[model samples]
Target: MATTALFFLFAGFAIACAVSMVYHRNPLYSAISLVGVFIALSCIYITLAAPFIAAVQILIYAGAIMVLVVFVIMLLNLEDDKPLNRLRYLYAVGGGLGLILLVQTFFIFYAVMRAPKQTVDADVTVGKTLSIGTAMYTEYLLPVEIVGILLLMAVIGGVILARRLEQPKLELVVDNELERRGEGEIKDEFRIRL
Candidate 1:
């Protein structure tokens, strides 16, 4: 099916980008990979027939968040950091075991808490933009506004940090050079250094 194929494609791309984001040494490259991951997530939403969610994923995650990250990277000029060191063998083994156990516990809890799907009216639009907007404004407006303000503050801070400082005064102007230098004394220091 088209949906299944798209789902797999997006999922693979998302995983690739996420891995690249983590492993890339360049901050700008990592930000770009993160944008790719966000876009792949948006595609997954589209495959699920949730166009509203897809749009938000594209607009907020890929657009706003990625831009902010890129801007911060540019502002900070952070290009010197090296890639992460490979983990030690014991640490890697332990982490793998811990991850497996965590996943197992999550599945067990999910299975225990699983609920039967209830039938709903067939007329409901699962991906309606208007409905999503209404819900967000009604239920999550405060949180959304707070996040927006935080982003604005971050942008302002970045701008302030990135601003260039005024050049320091080089030399004080002398109205009459005769006072500083003896009259008729040849100032020969202007010779070209070539």
Candidate 2:
């Protein structure tokens, strides 16, 4: 009963944080809410007896990914572009979808509660980090290496794109005759200083 209650609490918190992440106008606030969602998800994973997954969720998604997102947000320095009224239709559609999902979740939980409990297999080693690592290295090595290479390429591309281009400086020139005549204004006399 206590575990069930804790699961519901974390689930609700995750949902609320997800909603806040979507609804918040400020990007920083949205990112922070997303971090909260990640934490709540980590808690849920812990309750599911997957401590390795929970730790990875906290370390990878909550730690590395969120830090990258926040860094991007700060680097871009974005502002709210669209007015609330402009997104009214989007909000309506999202709300409708959320309502449908809530109803579905309610029915699913009710059905689960009505179902008979089953014993968990003691021989299952699915959630263990060692088993997962073995599977990844043996079965999914190629895909993992491909993803790593893609990430490396993306980093290289980002660096290349962010590099600043060098431009020639502009120089202002004044005529000595104009200076002697008290008309020293350098009108149309500016040129690129090579």
Candidate 3:
């Protein structure tokens, strides 16, 4: 009963955080909400008796990755775009989907409550760092290598985008006709033809 209550508590907290993350206007606030969601998920993992996954969820996702995301948001000096009223139509459509999801969640919980508990196999080693590392290196080596490569590529792409200093050459309006000026040339056409 205690475990079930804890699970529900963390699950509700996680859902609230997720909704807050989506509802926030500011990127930083959204990111902070996401951190809360991650922490709640860590608590859920704890309730499920997965200490290793819980620790990883807190350390890697909640700690390191959130810090990076917040740092990047600060570094880029991001601001909230337009208000959400522009997407009011989408919300009306999404309400139906949200109702469906709620019903599905209720049915899932009902099924879980009615399901029989299964005994863990004593022969199978689970949640050990050594066993996980062995499996990652032996069985999932290619997939792990591929993920690493993808992450590396993403980092490289981010660096390239950050270093791009493309100064747009001002379009010169000579005789009411647009003329492409050289990048080095400084013309009096202050109106940037965007």
Question: Number of the top candidate by lDDT?
Answer: 2
User: TM-score-based ranking, best first?
Assistant: 2, 3, 1
Write the candidate numbers in order of decreasing lDDT: 2, 3, 1
lDDT of 2 at 77: 95
Tens digits of per-residue lDDT for model 3, 3-78:
8999999899999999999888899999999999999998987666567778998999988999999999999989
Q: Give the clash count for model 3.
A: 0
Cα lDDT tens digits, model 1, 149-186, are 99999989999998876533331223135337664244
- Prediction 1 TM-score vs. true: 0.58
**How accurate locally, in lDDT, is each candidate?**
0.77, 0.84, 0.81
Error of 2 at 56 (Å): 1.6
> What's the C-alpha lDDT at position 169 in model 3?
49
Candidate 2 or 3, higher TM-score? 2
Superposed Cα deviation of residue 106, candidate 1 (Å) = 5.2
Root-mean-square deviation of each candidate, in angstroms? Answer: 8.4, 7.3, 8.1
